[model samples]
Target: MPTDPQAYRPATALLTLGEGFFDPVAPADFPETHLRFRNQRAAAEIGVDPLTDEEWIRHFGRFDPLPDTLPAPLALRYHGHQFRSYNPDIGDGRGFTFAQLHDASGRLMDLGTKGSGTTPYSRSGDGRLTLKGGVREILATEMLQALNVPTSRTLSLIESGEALARGDEPSPTRSAVLVRLSHSHVRIGTFQRLAYEQDESAMRRLIGYVLHNLYGEDGDDPIRLLDLVVARTATLAARYMAAGFVHGVLNSDNINVTGESFDYGPWRFAPTWDPAFTAAYFDYQGLYAFGRQPEAIHWDVMQLAVSLRLLVDTEPLIAALDRFAPLYGEAVTQAILWRLGVMPGDPDADRSLVQAVERALRDTEVPIDRFFFDAFGGRLPDAYGTGWTEVRDALAGRTARGERVHPYWSGAPCSMLIDEVEAIWARIDQDDDWSALDAKVAAIRAMGDALA
Candidate 1:
């Protein structure tokens, strides 16, 4: 806590990057251009005051020579498992945490930037983000919040007037910087890096830091830290399942050790419930698929436990790892039940509904957004149009599948709200009226609130 809660203050000191905390190479790639947004509005929501333009420049901005900033970045050097493979080297490739601030909400928030420039960890690529990626992240963060998912919020988006090149698209493309708000950017791999180096002292220090910064000092026992993190990971995994989200990449490097959801790369929501639904085109094996998320998280936690063993009792660590499965299962079941908005009527009906969802994913290939929208919301009338009719009819047909019909009929009242909204969307599309569309969306959103 600060003496003056309302006043914004500069960081007490600068944290410069070093070999001990990061790799020893420049970023493999750099953003050709850069842009910035205040995101002060978002900061305020979490109880942090925005810096004035001068303040931002004085504290965070490095607007001087091209690829500015002295690269005095530090406070990184965490390790994580990339796609289940132990990767000993990884940390702050293009960005670094400048400071950690205590928000008005009493939450400690990390102020970090992406596309700021390159560092030793840059590897063989430019450390920059495309404008499109920035925009998509903004939309994803906003939608995730609306849907009540635990995620890093986009604090700001800025464009640097530079050109860059990349394999996925083109070179010298426009660049943008994104500020991500999260509990901590620390990942499971952070510990892995130290463990791999045989640096037991550093690993112990890292565990101490995590316990103090994330879990708090009162409960700072290293054994308890392992237990808490494992349980938290399980809970988060369940939350993802409940919300129909698929984090395309669940590698150790991307799994935040703080237990807050971070590293939003090619993430998506389940259209139906296909176990293999994945957002990343490159995730060929579906290692991070929709259904495998829980398992991936479990694996990540196990990695964390193994790393933490340098400082804690091995038995307690193993015991913590063992708790993940049952906890995750209980959480998933509860989340699904709540999502269906059911009363405690028939146990078979709940079972049938889940089975029906699983079958729907296998039966057809449809847009994930449309599938959830139609099923959770409602079906559009035929007058709605091509996509609307398709979704409406699909839900109607899905309801007739064996024992599933019992819950389908019971859920109609809950589902009708979605159906009516789809009808309104169809009306708007037919009319090509923006104002009408906005008004209808507002009404539908209000209805969702009432239903919620």
Candidate 2:
């Protein structure tokens, strides 16, 4: 059944756990509330497409409580390992869970915020998001979704009319508040925090909450939860490889239990197949490089396993962790075949095809997105050379899914390269022109339609 556009089913499942898991906080008093962007498609799924621009700013920007929703925002509590070094002080420094509700598919979704205000976790830094940062996240999510990645959707971006200082970008830059729609806000770090406090009771409670609310499972089996999370995380890592995305920061806090990618920071789409390609400039050690993402994700899952030790036996957790390798291998194969738009063959043949495609991509050094765009339906030009011929042979006997009839496939694939992202922001920063951003999003969605 199609969802009733007027029926907005609000949920407060997280609030049922009480104040121990979070702190009630108010939003910042911004000087202005200008609606810079609003995702009508995402809003329609949540039954809020009827909200006017003014209403959007009023609710999202001003942090006004949505009707029958969260009475107030809750800054969630958690801890994380930064570059593998445990940090007990980190959580939602500049963000919070604004509200929770069901989507059209009846899945519980969170309406979370970024740059909303300072929280208990905001150390010495100011709680604000630069306008450029907000724009970058929008681009990241849009392009990832186009590639069929399970990612949080950018619901709205509101110019908060604040000037913020930062060392990363120019000082005193414009600021904004962003709302994202996600499946769950529960992270591996959330478990770590409870384990750190040695609160086994709270840890079990949290596990139960996740199992029931987010996963629709009844009883809380820590091993069962670990298995589910491991499988999802493995699939997520494969999707990242398939989409050519480098989520610069893969910290434990950034990884959600649902394995839906969110919280874009210093992210990049690889221009080529370079394994050493790092997204964040400060990643001097190349710890979270494009090629090393799978390892990093596996490491984060191990930390989750470590935290679950407070409630379960260690051997089962380790056994569950052991599943990562095969799961990731299988997922990457499926992901690559999906991207190529071809039916799968025998396991050996599919593996060979994936290997050949990777070799072709690396040896040719062609733009990754362009390669996928050009080679859609297993069609590669002769100019691609011997490496591509290997891929073609591997694709033999496999059926192409459908014809590439969409207009987006006619031209260059919509790519969110760093240069293009800056160009879009430059237009907005210099001439206050938003046409480029709007057009880019439309193109990305059209590409998604074609791929679908």
Candidate 3:
């Protein structure tokens, strides 16, 4: 961690794209501020992990710009389709991209906020996040990262000391502001807004910016861009399935251009292999259910393809879009094998094994997360009981990488069930005792280290 804040060079890479892209906005403070969490692992990217707790709170809590950060945060402009219906007015209502810095790996990272304050897009609702909501997102990101899902990390969370009323859960809920470390905040909705405006020049400029920065274009055309994004989206979709997760909202706006998952609202890990299992309680139609996630993500990618048409032709875009199904098919098998701790030398055989595993999980109705944590890092036939004998034999005669399971796995499986998460938070809510939350975080980190 760098001691000098001056060493932190914030890059306004997206801002350089110019007008209609984003608007300068200031973070409005709350009644009070108390830093709740800081992500040291993510902070080491920009070399600020060793800052004193007071210093961390001052910068993130006060919304103070890091040295050479953006003169002011930018509330990005974008439009998106919600549940397949186009909504042209939505953008960053409660959050803004605060700063950008290249990590040790030379990958550009963004420090973005949620519940910092209101903006032009704040419609009618208060531009605030519930403290409970903040805690939930923290847990969501931590668990997803532990499970090896490509996701954003919560860098900081602060209780904003505001009592807010809401209809979704209990009223007079505590409020908070959260900061996330992500590769980029640019989304598919960014392009959709430009397309809606019929600003073809802006569309081309945005595409060029994305290709030059994130996609690493080499004399590539829009077709190549579409193909790249399609592949990434397919890979991410497969990982989500293997992780047994359902991102309740896969709206176009929520689909990151980097194809990394973020914005973890109304998300859940499946307790079983049920296709119709939905995460968001408000999702009455089962639109973004666990099993339908692949379909939803593919549909979102289609929106990105449609936006690209403002700069390119129809034929190549269609061809690129066609790659989703096969790419997803191949990805799912690889993901399952990765979770099961095996190398796939034979594609046909590995696929058959995955199919058998899925059939077994469905027929036996085994708890989803427990099954993986217990079976992770290929085990021998004698290690399992008769109940798992079929699964063991099917995975027999296959090369399995060893040294995966830990001493902790021998007891109870490491799990992040909803009930457990709520119980952890309940302790904090009732007595401001954070020991449970801290213990859970430590355990999850240990699980990730063992898996690695």
Candidate 4:
């Protein structure tokens, strides 16, 4: 429990909430989103105490008045196609952005949550998110951040007191609230809903609001707004590909209008080179597979364009859509080169090297996480020549009867930037200093930045 709740603040509170958006619905409902994992380390960086169960209830048990200057973050109305059918009555049902806060890094980020409770948008059933879902989100966010992907950061996961009935899992496991920090939570469906309702005034207002708040509009021209959204969406998509991440659901409702990645559900990185990988349990048709992510993003951009018809010229919107492939390609190339510790040059060699590594990896089928963590250092077992004979011997799978296996033993292909990744087999075969390996990765990253 935090002794002073005022010590922590959401990103929304950093600046005055802009005008006329009705405040987020009251947090009167006592729907319990459980306390599971509080990212205390990350929260500490933002000066927030991830409270315990007893503490959470004691502190944030009732709704607190958001600063009066900021517009109440009214749940933006939206409609979208789920799995391909148009569902008109969907929006933020349980969670809302209570406020925004500035972190130690000085970034003004939105502090929002899920499974907080029902809202005016809660249609027919209980508006709750599962505890397991919270766990998966934490795992996904941690891995994606490590890979340097642009993603919403999870601040804390709290287990709620009430039980939730979910068909996918056991009856009444528990509910949870995941506090997230992101640039914005506005979605494409927000525009779509207004457009569908022919609420052209609100749509225009929202676009102008987004531009002023997110992109820093220099003038009042709406075309500039379209250009910003298009460019941001393209860059975001490219980063997603470069990180080998597949956002399983790119629904209009889930696609943040600000072009930031949000709603972390059903996401996975490519363990191998297969483009067909999907992290969503129900994506049976591979709608949002790794290979299709770029196209999916473009599709989402198109949906935004359709909704933007009220505000921007159709010709410019079409032209912006055309920029998706090239922009995404360039972003992906740059990101991959950065990750591999190499500059983007000689496309032919890069292609060949990547293909070879992919083939090796497919053959080895080792865990990707362990592969990178193991060979972060430039030195490899074979690099030291005959001095590494014991390392070589151990790599050959002949060891003392009671000898323990090395941490990096998983068979896998090394990245092309690894000058001597081949030496990993022998290096791990010998006792290796993990801290030394970490320093090596840091050095490589620094070198990559210098080259950049």
Candidate 5:
């Protein structure tokens, strides 16, 4: 890991696409800075893991655009469906794509910020992020990554030394700035905004840019793009189910074009198999509930298909949209075995094993997370429950035997339960103690490393 933050000058690849996609923006000045977290693993991607905390604040907190990074931060513009309603006045209101750099594998990665400052899209809101919100997102991404979900990583989080009054969770919450590293910041809403404005030319350009830069396809064949995105989205939905995560908002703006999950806001990992479990408090209708996620995602993809109509014929796009259900089903079946640490020997047998596992867990009322932790590597506990006989028989085909799993799995599983999260924050708020938060993150990362 390089010790200096300025070692790599990112390509700022998105800037090459041109004027209509984004607007230049700067970060808000904070009263003080305390570097809270730095993802060393993520830093190794761009070779900046060795930077000192002071250097971290200088580059990430001071809002000094690195001379080698993006020339200037750009607040991307896009519109989206908010709660299934068309909202044209939405964009990067509180954050911007700070820079883009190539990872060790040569995939272009974006360094984006949240709670940076106000922009043209900040209609009536203060563009500040609560410290609690920052902590929540860090946990969300870490837990999702541990469960093998395609997601972003929190690169840096710094307390901005400002207390803010907010109506949501708590008043006078501390403020923060968060940096996340992801494959792309371009969203489905990007196309929606272009289509809504009747900018077919920009739409075509954007499509080609996404395909070429992100997908490694040279030409803008919109049909092929649709199929790729559809397949990825299907697997994405399956990943969420296997992980028991409810991604509060399935809006077009929150759905990345790359289909990797990011922009976490009231995300939660289900403690049980409750389908109607909703993550966000305001989702009264349960539209984006755990069970409705697949439906909501399919609907969002249709809107994306609608935008692609400007360039491609309707039949092919429709055909791509039709693949989601089957693909999602197949992916979930395979993911079940993967999570169980089995090699998935036979397709039909794998499906049967998954069905058996689900039936057993649902019948016994065993927590989904606990089942996975206990039965990891195909080891069933000696003590049998109501469904263990069948579960044991089904797992017999699991040829999983001795394998190297981290010691963390042998102990109590680290969970992202909301009560536990609130307790961690309570210590910080009441006694200014940060050890609990630090230990939680460390345990989460250890689990992720074991999964890898």
Candidate 6:
């Protein structure tokens, strides 16, 4: 039976864990609440598709409590490693868990806000998000979701009518508030904070809450939890590679226990298969570059294991961490095959195909997305060298997944490279034109459907 799109089921699951996990905070009062973007597809899943634009602003922009759900927004607290440097003074500085609900599939969903307001963790900075920053996040999430990456969906964007100064972008930029729909907001840093405080009881309680509410498990066994997180994180890293995405920041706090990618900032798609391709300008050392992402993610998972050490012994945790490399390798093979729209082969054959693809990508320096686009369903044009020929041979005997009937597959691949991102933002910034953004999203979704 199809679930009713109008029947919203709200949950207070996070509240059950107690107030120590979060601090209640108020949303910023924006002078103007002009709705910039609304994710109807995401809203339909959560049973909020029927909301009018005015009503949407009231809830998302003005921060009205959802019916029978959270009475106040929660500014979640945690600590994290920023660029491998431990920072205890970080948390939900500008965002909060606004509300919780279940999607059509009955999975717990969080309606979280970014740039909502200032919290105790604001740390002398204004609690706000740039309008351009919000726009970038929208593009990043949409493209990632289209690429089948496990990620947060941008639910709403509303211009807040504020001028803000930023060091990265042009000063006096526009401001906006964004709402994201995600599976879980409980991060690795959430556990790290408890361990840092040496509060074993709180750590155990949080573990129990996470396993039950987010993962649908009931036990608080640290080893079990670490194993699960490790596997999911590995899959996530593999997907990022398949999509040629540089997350720019793979800090422990940005990594949630659910392993769903969220909090997009300084994200970029690799133009070519360059290991040192970095997305963030401030990442001088290339610590979180495209090639190092797997390592960074593994390191973050290790932090989670360290945090869990407060509750369990070290040897089992080390055993769990050992699973990451093998799991990541397997996941990479699977992810690449899926992107290539081909049936799985034997492990050795599949690995050979992946390696061949990598070699072709590096040797040809072909645009990453274009290479995948050109090689769709194991079909590659003859205009390439031995590396591509190696890839073509490795793909032999594997059945393509489905017919590429969609019009999108007949054209150049839809990509979200940085220049296109800047052009999209320029349209909105200069002329308030959203036609390009809309068109790109339509194209991206069309590609997603074709790939599907």
What is residue 438's positional error in candidate 6, in angstroms?
A: 0.9
Candidate 2 per-residue lDDT, tens place, 1-452, comes to 22344658888899877788999988999999889899989988888888878778888899888877789999999999889999999989999998898998888999999999898889996889999999999999999998989999999999988899988778889999999999999999999999999998888889899999888898889998999999999999999999999999999999999989999999999999998999999999999999999999999999999999898889999999999999999999999999988888899888889988888888889889888888889888677775577887887677887688878777887788989999999999999899999999999999889988
Q: What is the C-alpha RMSD of each candidate to the true structure, in Å?
A: 8.8, 1.8, 2.0, 10.3, 1.9, 1.8
Q: Candidate 6: list runs displaced more than 4 Å.
A: 1-7
Local distance difference test values of all predictions, in order: 0.60, 0.91, 0.83, 0.59, 0.85, 0.91
Q: Candidates ranked by lDDT, best first?
A: 6, 2, 5, 3, 1, 4
Over 426-448, each residue of candidate 1 has an lDDT whose tens digit, in order, gives 45335633353334333433434
Highest lDDT against the true fold, candidate: 6
User: What TM-score does prediction 3 earn?
Assistant: 0.95
User: Which residue runs of candidate 4 sit more than 4 Å off their true CA positions?
Assistant: 1-24, 28-35, 44-73, 103-107, 345-452
Assess candidate 5 and give its TM-score to the true structure.
0.96
Distance from true location, Cα of 427 in model 3, Å: 1.0
lDDT of 3 by residue, 122-159 (tens): 89968899888888888888888887788999999999
Which one wins by lDDT: 2 or 5?
2
- Greater-lDDT candidate between 1 and 5: 5
Model 5, position 411, has a per-residue lDDT of 82
Model 1 weakest lDDT span, ten residues long? 9-18
Expressed as tens digits, the lDDT of each residue in 99-171 for candidate 4 is 6665566555676777666787888757666765765576556545555666787776766666778887677
Which 10-residue window in model 4 sums to the lowest lDDT? 395-404
- Residue-level lDDT for 410 in candidate 3: 61
Per-residue error (Å), model 5, residue 151:
0.6
